[model samples]
Target: MPNLTITEMNNLKEELKKKGYKLTPQRRAIVDTIIENEGKHLTVEEIYDEVKKDCPEIGLATVYRTILLLEELQIVYKLDLNDGCSRYEMVHKDEIHRHHHLICTKCGSVIEVEGDLLENLEVKIEKQYNFKIKDHSVKFFGICQNCGE
Candidate 1:
């Protein structure tokens, strides 16, 4: 699992600072939670649950704000599949696992897949469509084994 230590947390803050973002406590907690729960595409409520452990006073609105900021920074990504709920992933620059999601329709569970596969698809799409792909995301949704009947 991709987890971050206090040092890593501090380093991330420094990196964000370099990117002109001051790391607030709420942002740090959310980012830490994302790293700890890496590969899980967490909804804002789920993130709020994890973040409240460290920042008990933080609110859901703050969670939403922090995630939006992170997404703008390319530090977090969202998967909106024509569904009301949007799931988020942390952008781990050093990890092998990446942002694609395999969502279990019945249980709403999420799995992460390596990104190189999608890179290949992007190449193919660009070749066929001649549309320069700036960035891309992929999601697979189906009944999980537990509910696959």
Candidate 2:
């Protein structure tokens, strides 16, 4: 688990500018919402709710479009799971995108875990099973602590 920093945000904004992006006031508000909620992976609806506080005229469709643009710019990453709407997090992966998470099925709680758990398994599949693996995503689902109670 890591925190999003102002420095990273600055870099992202600069990157966006280099790519001919104009930061509209509404878009800035949306990006602020995402940073203010660093570790909490948020869906478009959730982001729109937060963005609305700053830009009352902002629409859900605008949020969706902004999210898609940011994702294309690699300023955001979309999380894929078997359930629920897509959630997004801001990340700049210059190195290995090496994080996995556990998701609670009942309450939709997400817990971050590290340390290349799939590395050895991927290697074994390539060697023993003769399967050349490019990449993989794994998300375990179960009842979370609060939900279990």
The C-alpha lDDT values of all candidates are 0.77, 0.79
lDDT of 2 by residue, 3-83 (tens): 337787577778789989887777778887888887788889999998898789999999999999998887788887666
The true-versus-predicted C-alpha distance at residue 87 of model 2, in Å, is: 0.8
Q: Best candidate per lDDT, number?
A: 2
Per-residue CA lDDT of candidate 1, range 1-149, in tens?
Answer: 23467786777777788878888767878887887876666789999998898789999999998888888877887878546888887776674445566778888776666655767777889999999877666679887777786
RMSD for all candidates, in order, please.
3.3, 3.6
**Poorly placed runs, candidate 1 (over 4 Å):** 1-11, 81-83, 94-98
TM per candidate:
0.75, 0.77
Which stretch of 10 consecutive residues in model 2 shows the poorest summed lDDT?
1-10
